[model samples]
Target: MEGILNILKPPGMTSHDVVDFIRKIYNTRKVGHTGTLDPDAAGVLPVCVGGATKFVSYLVEQDKRYRFEITFGFSTDTLDKSGKIIKSGPVRFLKEKELRQVLREFEGKIKQIPPIYSAKKIKGKKLYEYAREGKIIDIPPIEVTIYNIDLVEYESPYQVLIDVKCSKGTYVRALVRDICEKLNMPGYMSMLIRTEVGAFRIEDAYTLEEIKEKKPSLQPIDKFIKLPSVHLNKIEAEKILKGQFISNRHSIETSFLKLYDNNGKFLGIGVSERNKIRPKRLL
Candidate 1:
């Protein structure tokens, strides 16, 4: 049972909760999740089974997409609906033209300050720990990329829906807060749903119940990896097993190859640099 699972994590369950559920369902400790979906969020959470857990570091490089709602005229400690209200004010609904222009500011590379009540660690302690202790600290700004952002619709003067595509580590709650600040109104995330993560999408996701009933729903591990396969002959296979990188400079393809033995066994990953191929991982 080693492969990728498009698990539909329901709201109110932490990412760890889902992982634990899978570990029990599969009766294996090798289970792991590709990304962490917040407790209040629900959607596609890719789960790694069996040896796929070894590739988690590489999967984290993939981008994520989300659809979330923002509630204006108020702010919360946790920046979401579950948090305590810390501030409130009147919010004037901006025109569509105005909203569009405001959204434009978010596209491309931008600096973002993460919400205080977050998983970020500060001085070897989680930021949420400090937040829980009512400690305020200057959280540094981080550079992040927002590939795309579109206003889905305005649900009300106080609420609006937005779809976003961003690089890893982006916090949608913070994005909503920043947008509200730009509009001169306090804001907090009212609802969030991660529609996609990397190549996984919510539409293909299976609920926990579905997995328990359907035993063989898991896809092959290599299907989710999607790396460029490079078949190594007898001589080349030995070099890879010995932690050596061999160059295929003689060949037309110059990019990194998803290494595989002559027997078609996946041998982890490798990169081609100059005239040499360096192994990045070993199965």
Candidate 2:
């Protein structure tokens, strides 16, 4: 009832819809998704249930990998096929050599403008909410790092597929917009598939149908957390749960460490502050 579900979210269902589905299946309102995947994009989405919900913020900060397609011909209001055709013009392409260079230019740290129809928030409200109200707002460029970007395949005259590994905030639709602008052409994201998010991969994800038909076991929360561990006796474990900082008995240097009971049951995470360990999050 408590752990993460690597869901292979199919196109058309919003990320929140998946969370609602999990809530019903597990019969617990404690479920939540780690990150938001656009309703039109399909792939790996990590949904956390029960105590695992507390770690969603941290898990969502991890880097992600995606395979997306960019079609050059027209630009859409949403920057994807679902939006209205806002701009159209004769398409042009850089030679294969020039195209690769253009993609390389996007690698590393760069400022990106997110699409107006995205979930990015502004003034404490989701951007899409403003767009739906027909309100125009200046969307600022955000600094995001693209760890790796490569031209996967280029189809004749119009479509180009790409694989990108980027920081948490990188929007693939926005990336397509920038690339098209760099090439001085009109384009929109034709397709998108999230291949990986931190340690969660598409191959290990389950569909809604599979999950409902065959209930599966949940994983331990600490399985993906990388940290040194400290095992505490009953007395020490009780002290931690009481919100009292304990002496750094093990003298661990890391800023954080995994906590466990003497019986090897995972407790949660601990913050190492001033040589004292405090319960940061407990299951």
Best by lDDT: 2
At residue 158, give the lDDT of candidate 1.
82
Evaluate all candidate structures by whole-model CA lDDT and list the values in order.
Answer: 0.85, 0.90
1-283 per-residue lDDT for model 1 (tens digits): 4677889999999989999988888888998888888888899898887877887776777899999998887899889998999999998868988887898899999999988888888799889999989888989998899999999999668888899999998988889889988889988998889988888888988998898888545676666665677888888889988998786744535465678888998777787777788887776
Model 2: lDDT of residue 141: 94
Q: What's the TM-score of every candidate structure?
A: 0.92, 0.95
Residue pairs whose backbone atoms clash in candidate 2: none
Model 1 has an lDDT value of: 0.85
Of candidate 2, the 10-residue stretch with the lowest lDDT total is 215-224
Off by over 4 Å in 2: none
Q: Which ten residues in a row have the lowest lDDT in candidate 1?
A: 248-257
CA RMSD of all predictions: 2.1, 1.4
